[model samples]
Target: MLINDNQEQIAIATYGLTKIYERNIAVNEVDLQIKQGEVYGLIGPNGAGKTTLIRMLATAEEPTKGEIYLNGDRLLQDDTNPHLKQYLGYLPDDFPLYDDLNVIDYLDYFARLYKLSKPLRKQRLQEVLETVNLENKRNSPIATLSRGMKQRLSLARTIIHQPIILLLDEPVSGLDPIARLEFRQAIKLLQQAGMTILISSHVLSDLAELCTSIGIMELGCLVENSSLDNLYQKFSKQQILISTLGEYDKLEQQLKNCPLIEHWEKLSQKNHYLAHFTGNLEDASELLKQLIKADIPLHNFHCEKENLETIFLNLGHQQTS
Candidate 1:
């Protein structure tokens, strides 16, 4: 379904994207664009190709240099579109099923291998076993479930063929914080059924609380690709923290008469203060309206939004220093 049913985009564009094996370079050249229903996150570490650029955007390899645009069509994953496998639904960080197929006959054997018809494959296998709740483990025994019910029966076979773009490798890797909160409420019920995910996880706070745009592969190269508030408003550096209702030596002598606070210190006692933002937010908002017109007792203030594991350890310590 080459997206454009009034543009419900599910993007994954790339260019200059490279990959190599025997001779090294796992990923490089990478440029990116990921939008659609946007849950995009692909952080790095562990040989940082982020699983070979998500196995070449789930086309399952083939791209020593590249192009990938899911909803904007231009397909491949051995393209021969049988509705492009109902719009991709890969789940590969080892999501192989059929241990004597049980959970509703393994989602009615992939909804009749996506051929669907037998009463719409029993209505999309009872609607993906109630969107992965696994309705009473629908006749259990995929080898006695539980590794979080076999990761919610592999997300009910990656949404029994209703795939509107999903590629979730490491989908809750070996759960058990109550099955990773029931597989994060079955991926927030597949993003409220609008689906368009592209997750990868080494759990960075569960992809910083279930992604809202991210793309940070390292060695393979597309370092950061936006929106976690535009990647901390374009690579962070807006840290403000002032906690004084009274003397931190008169708020560090009224913040050393506010010189657009390029840097300040005293992180404890005398009250507490910290500042750094020479990126000059209009001289740090005219030094916070001249400390509220010199009343000074600003009891508390905090502004620390540069977290995604602190922008993934400051971009892996600025690419290994």
Candidate 2:
């Protein structure tokens, strides 16, 4: 069933998506659909076939089996499909470049490849250069630019055609902290431009920061598919941190006595403890009330949501064990 059917905000779709290599199943049977104008994330551990999946979606490589639709048109088959090439842009994890060409020359050359006319080509070149903040280096040779610059240049080329859908494979993989931040800002610009983006990254924090919807793959299965917020809620372990005025020894004993307190540990000082309460938050609250009534000083307490790394680790562990 096509969940996104007739939705004006739909971009990519795959039915029974599969890619095989002889006896090895690179990507197992999968179903994926992404809405337009959202930063969707394809997250997985190393060699989880995220790259291969993105490649198939980009129309660069054919899938062993299954079908992909871009902008509601089946990919790479019909030239007359109005929703074909014009609706797509793909940026690989490792962007290739022409070392001999300068920045402006490089972008202009790609514009011509996308069949833009003379005046339109210049306009697009200028727009993309500014978009990626490469106008200052417009005359610089591609070989002279930094890795970050190269990534930005590659992005400029990807958007030179003004593609409506973008399949980016680890677009921010190799960059310094400042460069990564700049790259993130560039992505935000793309998002505001209303580009349908599918970004694949092994970096959990970066993905967590940029993506709104996410799909997690492992062992050739789409183990999870939902909005990032929902995934966090579904898999997250809720806990709380607290600091008391009195020593935590009494509190530690209280913690051990409560069956509802699944796990907890003392913090740096004698009066603080980071507590993990899995079963019932209200029961944990009742325990806290009892502690307060018993003269166990309660200074501060706040809920702590599990971070994306913890979610990933827990998922990976569940899949294995």
Candidate 3:
């Protein structure tokens, strides 16, 4: 279900957007809506049509049917609606960069292409370099940078025009742990700056950390779309971990009495137990109260919500070849 927050303005909306190649439907009547300043994560398997949808949104590939709107303005592939392009910045999985040009020069070239004035170009170049943490490599050749640095540079180029909406397709495809961390930090900084971002990546952990909302696509169709909180409330199972200083058997007996607890198992650690809780916060609180009343010598009791991967798998939308 699409979130309808009347107070928030829609940054991007697509009505029955679709793309077809031969008899194969690349995107099947997708009606996507993203609010301004939202970090929307798109997730699916390799052949899920995420790239096709994003390419259509970027105006890089024209959709065979449907209409795209940017801030209430219809986005046209033709030259008549050229101004709509300014509000968008798209970064594909593989982007071409000028290997011979230094970082600053390459950014300047794109800035000029976007028709930014000389003064604005200079200001934006510096700002984007700083945003991506590439200030030190401003004069370094693109070919000399590491894979992570190159990705960051590509991102800087995408945002050099300071677009209100950013589209990223697998922005962290190949990078070491440290590099991915750095790239994630850059994305957080961008989110803090209030740019509506839509990112499609196989990294569910990253998406869990960054996305305000998530959409799951399968076989060219969007099967799930919801705000992260709602999705969690609806699908994520709540688990409670308890550590007691008292005997494990006594704790187990007390847990068995509680109807809210579906089941529980002893942890590898002594006197630690993990319980599958089937209730809301208040029920969990009542369980804690009952445990205390039973004098189980509870030392640690905390809830652990199911992570994104667990939720995704539980929803039965596993990737297919």
Candidate 4:
């Protein structure tokens, strides 16, 4: 279940959304709700059904049983509601590009396909090119661009029609560090544009930096879904780092004396230690006061929360065999 504000408008929702093959249930009954303008990250191990759920939402694949909604309107796979397609931009992991066409021409082609007026197409092409930082390569052939550029070009094509919601699957799969950083920047720009984006990626660190909320999948079931803040509050372990100029032994003894500290570890740096803190800010302050009273030359003291990756691994969700 998703922990969301009741007042927030839901841009995408699913009810009992499921998919099945001959013997395997690719996606179990999943009830998901994503608020408008939210960057919702989906993470899980291989064969966890993340792709299947995304495909169903993109209308590329039909669900065996379930209902999908956008802005409170039911979405049907049939062509009866063409307007619904206009509201969504779906980019699969393997996105095709016209290698022969120039960047501008390629975007123009998709814009025309979406029935954008010539004047509007011209305007939108420039906007998208700028958004993806591909303005310099507007006239460059798609085949000449690097892997990262190709991905950004594909993203530009996806948004050429100005879709309100975007569904992206493993957008940064095989790119190098620089390429991945570029892609992340483009996604941030899109988010600032107020597009509700659902992204699935194995890169938890990127998701940690990008997503407003996250949903974890395992064996076709959504086992966890919550806002980042809420997830941190509930699952993140707090630790305190203390750097002192005084004697290490004295600092260690002081930490051992504190009941609020579960345990402490000596760091590689001189006179620096990490303590597993179990109390609130007030308790931390009291501990700091005690250290000062003991004449420990404390130079730095601060709390560090567990990151998304640590919390995810600690949850013990494994990939399908």
Which candidate leads in lDDT? 4
Q: Which prediction has more favorable lDDT, 2 or 4?
A: 4
Q: Which residue pairs in model 4 clash with each other? A: none
Please provide TM-scores, in order, for all candidate models, with all chains considered together.
0.35, 0.87, 0.85, 0.88
What are the per-model numbers of colliding residue pairs? Answer: 3, 0, 0, 0
**Order of models, best lDDT first:** 4, 3, 2, 1
Enumerate residue pairs that collide in model 2.
none
Query: Which digits, one per residue and each the tens of the lDDT, describe model 3 over residues 101-201?
Result: 99999999999999999999989998999999999999999999999999999999999998989999999997888888999999999999999999999
Give every collision pair in model 3: none
* Best candidate according to TM-score: 4
lDDT on C-alpha atoms for all candidate structures:
0.76, 0.83, 0.91, 0.92
Model 1, poorest ten-residue lDDT window?
1-10
The candidates, ranked best first by TM-score, are 4, 2, 3, 1
| Runs with alpha carbons beyond 4 Å of true place in candidate 4 | 1-5, 243-250, 266-272, 292-300, 317-321
For candidate 1, lDDT tens digit of each residue in 1-321? 234445645466677878888799988888777767778878888887877777777778888767777766665656575555577788887867777878898788777877778987888888878877888889877988878888778877877878878888778876767888778788878887778788888787877787888888777777678777778677767778777677456567667766666668876575677887554556666766677677777877666655687778887898899
lDDT of 1 at 79: 51
- Model 2, runs deviating above 4 Å: 1-8, 77-83, 243-248, 266-273, 279-300
What is candidate 4's lDDT per residue for 1-321, written digit by digit as tens?
233467778999999999999889999999999999999999888998999999999999999999998888889999888888888999999978989999999999999999999999999999999999999999999999999999999999999999999999999999998999999999999999899999999989999999999999988999899999998998988899999997778889888888888899989997789999999888899899988988988999998888888888877533422
Q: Tens digits of per-residue lDDT for model 2 on 1-321?
A: 234646454678888888888888888988988887889998888778888898888777778889888766677644566458677788887667999999998888889888999988988888888889988999999999998889989899999999988888988886888778778888989999888889988778888898889999997777888999999889888787888888567888888887777889887786778877775667667877888877887888777788888898888998999
